[model samples]
Target: MPSTSDQTLENQNDEELNSLHGKIKALRSVTIDILDDSNRQNDQLDRTGNTFTQFTNSLFSTSRHHSRSMAASSTVRQYRTIAYIVGAVVLLWLVLKLWSFGGTRSVPPDGVNGEYRI
Candidate 1:
């Protein structure tokens, strides 16, 4: 039979081993969780990168289209500018004509026959 002290020592060793095992299991669970979180973050980053790329491509295409349209319509743009200037001139002329037509009238003096009233 084992001595009483030896039994006590064995029990203590068993308890310590169980505690160490529990700690190891906890560490393994935490490591797995970390790996899962990292994978999710990587997937999200990839999706974001792809979305940004698509948006950039769309923006570039729109800018190119706008540039082409502007280049092609330069004559139209010039005509529009001239029309704006002519419209402004016509509006100014109309305003001046109306103002002159509505000129102020001279009022007669306040008198009975030819002598002014006191």
Candidate 2:
């Protein structure tokens, strides 16, 4: 019952609708892929957070253990600390003396004999 012109218009509209349907399907597929990727990233982040938490707990435990051990007899005694300080001072003085000696070129005075310079 439709005229030729109406039939042509109806066919064009049907073709446009099919094209739009195809585009919607593509968009849905892309959205689903994005959702899957987001979920994967979230899971990875959660695992990393758990790993960090475990590491923090381990660090705290080690720190507490170290403090406890240091409180026991492993700490440096007073005489040992004093000896160490004295040894360090002597080492520093020796190093400075050596440095000063290295910087000076030993030359005999104009009239002084080389044998007398030692």
Candidate 3:
């Protein structure tokens, strides 16, 4: 059997409690929304990072292939130059040797003073 004044005070306390509860619920809802937005941002960042990685990988692979092709082309050119140089040297040597062998005059068929004629 509470007095009227005590009952009024209890009612005021109950109203205050309800008000605090409502504020707590509103804060919780706002916090949840913020967390959800943060998660979405994180997911988007992950996707962007993956896409960048893939692009870089492709670029690197293409560059590697190009480098290899250029190296091969350089090697072929070097080999061809060396072959041409070697062939030219060999041809010059053969021509010089043949000229030296063929240029010496042999003894003439008619003898003059017992010496062969040029």
Candidate 4:
């Protein structure tokens, strides 16, 4: 049988120990929650990284496609311009040839009296 004061002191010590244990359990629970949150964040980061990579690849692919098309369009425009210039030059040359061929001829100094010449 202990004295009343000793029993009171023992009860106080038990209460303090129980409180410490409860706090420890709560702290451990919080730690586990933090770890779970970090893991979830890590998973989200991985997904975001993959998405960014895919987006970058898609942009590059689109850029390449656009660049190729633009290059082809530029080439086509150049060819069309050259064709137009060549066509115009050919048309001018043909006109000049026809003009020279159709020029007036001078009369012959001696005229023939044969039927074909007349």
Candidate 5:
């Protein structure tokens, strides 16, 4: 049979080992929870990244289309301005020519007496 001192030491050793085992199990559970949380965060980050990329692509395409339209509109406006300028110049030239030709004519004898000049 074992002595009293030996038995006491054996019991102490068993208690220490049991405590260590319990601590190890608790640590394993905590590590598993940390790993699960990390995986969830990674998934969320990927989704957010994808959404941002799509939005950026859409914005770029819209801006490109608007720029093209604006360029076309500006070209049309330039043509219209040129046409108006040319028309005004032609009208002024015609009016001046007509005025010079009409002023050089002689008046009739009936209109020279007391009637207003036509």
Candidate 6:
């Protein structure tokens, strides 16, 4: 009877050791899965950051081009206004000179109030 009881105790110890080993294996698998998920999340964040940087750079470039174009257009407008002012001044001077002539005729070269005609 004592031998039989010793054998039963040994069997229970073996069963408990196997159960503990299986539980340890399950914990290890769970830890590995968590690490994989973390790595994946970090990679996704890096991609998103890169994409945002590219978008911002493109937007900045477009705005710079537009600003330069607007500055050139403003310069052209200023030149056009100056040209118009000069043309108007010239026209006014011509009109004034013509009015002074007053449809008058030129005197003949052959002596009008002269003692001798050259």
| Per-residue lDDT of candidate 6, residues 1-118 (tens digit) | 5698899999999999999999999999999999999999999999999999999999999989867866778778767867999999999999998988886556545555644333
Candidate 2: tens digits of C-alpha lDDT, residues 1-118:
9999999999999999999999999999999999999999999999999999999999999989867765674446645766888999999999999999998767665565545354
TM-score for candidate 1? 0.63
RMSD of each: 21.9, 16.1, 32.2, 32.5, 29.9, 33.8
lDDT digits (tens) for residues 18-117 of candidate 4 = 9999999999999999999999999999999999999999999998986787677878786886799999999999999999978845454445562332
Each prediction's total of clashing residue pairs, residues at least 3 apart in sequence or on different chains, is 0, 0, 0, 0, 0, 0
Model 4 pairs in collision: none
Candidate 4: misplaced stretches above 4 Å?
75-118
Q: Between the candidate structures 1 and 4, which one is better when assessed by TM-score?
A: 1
Off by over 4 Å in 5: 75-118
- For 1-118, candidate 3 gives per-residue lDDT tens digits of 9999999999999999999999999999999999999999999999999999999999999989867866778788767867999999999999999999897767665654665565
What TM-score fits each model? 0.63, 0.63, 0.59, 0.58, 0.59, 0.55
lDDT of model 5 at residue 74?
A: 78
**Superposed Cα deviation of residue 76, candidate 1 (Å):** 6.0
Report the Cα lDDT for candidate 4: 0.88
Off by over 4 Å in 1: 75-118
* CA lDDT for candidate 6: 0.87
Off by over 4 Å in 6: 75-118
Q: Which of the two, 1 or 3, has more lDDT?
A: 3
Greater TM-score among 3 and 6 belongs to 3
Give the per-residue lDDT of model 1 (tens digit) for 37-103. Answer: 9999999999999999999999999989867876788888968867999999999999999898788
Query: What lDDT score is found at residue 72 in candidate 2?
Result: 71
Scored by lDDT, the top model is 3
Is candidate 2 or 5 superior in lDDT? 5
**What is the lDDT for 80 in model 2?**
73
Can you write out model 5's per-residue Cα lDDT over 8-105, one digit (the tens) per residue?
Answer: 99999999999999999999999999999999999999999999999999999998986786677877876786799999999999999999998764
